[model samples]
Target: MRQIGLVIKTEGNRAWVKMQKGASCGEEHCPLSSSLIDDSQDDFYTVCAINSVGAKSGDQVMVEVEDLFLLRTAFMIYILPILAGILSYALLNYFLKIPSLTYTGTFLSVGIIAILLKRADRKLNFPYRIVELGTASVCISCPLKNRNEQQKLKP
Candidate 1:
């Protein structure tokens, strides 16, 4: 999915981008809604994105994050633990013949798996990339357009 962000600052090969609020995807259960709302609240929260496109501070750019990556992340976070738990329970119950230890084994396996995954995630690179950099469009109802116009009139 594509989102617009303003380059707020630059350091070396990275640009800190302040993401702008955009129209929802119309999904009834959008997982990104909470993050999007929080990001829109203030420029305090910014993403340090790769500046491969040569985006400079004050530039408006389009950031593209793959939907496939998002889906995979969601599946890893939500489904992997349940699968691990079930497998642990089955192995403990059938192979070890310990029916009483099934729940304990399941919970322990899930916790261990989650901790390992969390650690692995820290080493993984983000799947999103900067696709383009361009001017912010002006429209009659665009709030950013008004802000830009005001900035232009200031000096």
Candidate 2:
């Protein structure tokens, strides 16, 4: 379902929007679901979609949610790479005892792996992307979705 909402809060890599769909003046408080993070206030909770619409406080937004479980897993996928890199790097030396590889090598390897993952990540078709203010240079793929509908997103 697609929703038109307003951004209520911004927190560590996530923005919480109080979906207009669930808002009612007489309701006193609006209940919201966050795709990434929940940072809501007394009357409203924040949404956690990407800053694609350039959605600011009080700005209306159109959002599409797939599935609740899917949303949770999507977030996991985005975080797994960094976790893997950190875990592997730490284990490679302290536990694996492949001491021949220097710390520089570990860092370099992590960087290279991250770069490669990011390059591959560009092909995904996620629900959101930060819409560029002017130039299209800083647009990044939504790490939360598939690859075909990518261009259909804001960035």
Candidate 3:
């Protein structure tokens, strides 16, 4: 969805865009939210926003989200550790009949699961969209590159 709004607020790397109904005619209206993706953050390296629309404060700009699922998956990685810990404890106690080793096994399983899941998510793609606040343009895009392209670019 396109926001076609102005920069109502900006703190650090995030910006909130004010949405307009039809066109921006200098009137107060609903506002939408957007964030500037910084390449310094590895996760957002391939999702950098192309600022060709000349975005500025009070200047209607557009923002886009390329991969929504991938974004959600990133968050899931955080929860996996907790789930793994509990599952480990339960499995050891119930299946293996090893109650005494539950706690240690639980923590170890959590660490392992978290690391593995994080790596997996990095290699997958999430549902994404681009929000052009200024032009009120939104495009669903993917951060994943084609296997052939990757092979060609690799050293």
Candidate 4:
């Protein structure tokens, strides 16, 4: 998937971007509109992406997520549990002749797989890269000066 974001910080060829929400995602009803990153404290979420085009802070750019990675993630989330349950039932009921315990085994296997996948989630960081740069000069809240201004306004 592709997204438009502002480069909030750049270091060692990686850019920390704040992705735009709503129509900027090119979807009328985007599912990721409310998704937040690790350090999101405002309207937009931050992501560290590969700086393919050498984008700098305040530069608006386009970032693309790997489609294959998305497909693999979907399969793991949607299909793996079903497969585990079916295998559990087949082995427990058909091979072991324990009809009474088939459903229990299936449930247990699925639960175990879910726990494993949840733990695996931490290691999955799909690559996002800058594909194109936009002409926008700066973001609505940027240049570090705006952050300082907001701090002074607090009572």
Between prediction 1 and prediction 3, the one with superior lDDT is 1
Query: Using alpha carbons, what is the TM-score of model 2?
Result: 0.33
Cα lDDT tens digits for candidate 1, 12-118 = 88887776433224322444544555545432235678888988888876666778876887788789999999889988888778767787888899999899888
Report the alpha-carbon TM-score of model 3 versus the true structure.
Answer: 0.41
The candidate that achieves the highest TM-score relative to the unseen native structure = 4
Per-residue lDDT of model 3, residues 1-155, tens digit only: 22233455454555544432222212223121112232232211122234444455554455544455545764676676777777788888887676667777887888788788868857864322224443313323211122254321111
Tens digit per residue, CA lDDT, model 2, 1-155 = 34444456655555666543233222224333332234442333334677765555554455555666446644555665567667767877786576666465577766776787667666654454333322222223222123254322221
Model 2 clash tally, residue pairs: 11
Candidate 1 runs further than 4 Å off = 20-45, 134-155
Candidate 4 regions exceeding 4 Å error are: 20-44, 135-155
What's the lDDT for residue 106 in model 3?
81
Model 4 residue 94 CA deviation in Å:
1.2
TM-score, each model? Answer: 0.66, 0.33, 0.41, 0.69
- Candidate No. with top lDDT: 4
Q: State the lDDT at 67 in candidate 3.
A: 52
- Winner on lDDT between 1 and 2 is 1
Error of 1 at 127 (Å): 3.7
lDDT of 4 by residue, 30-76 (tens): 55554453234344557789998999898777788988887899899
Ranking by TM-score: 4, 1, 3, 2
Candidate 4: pairs in clash:
none
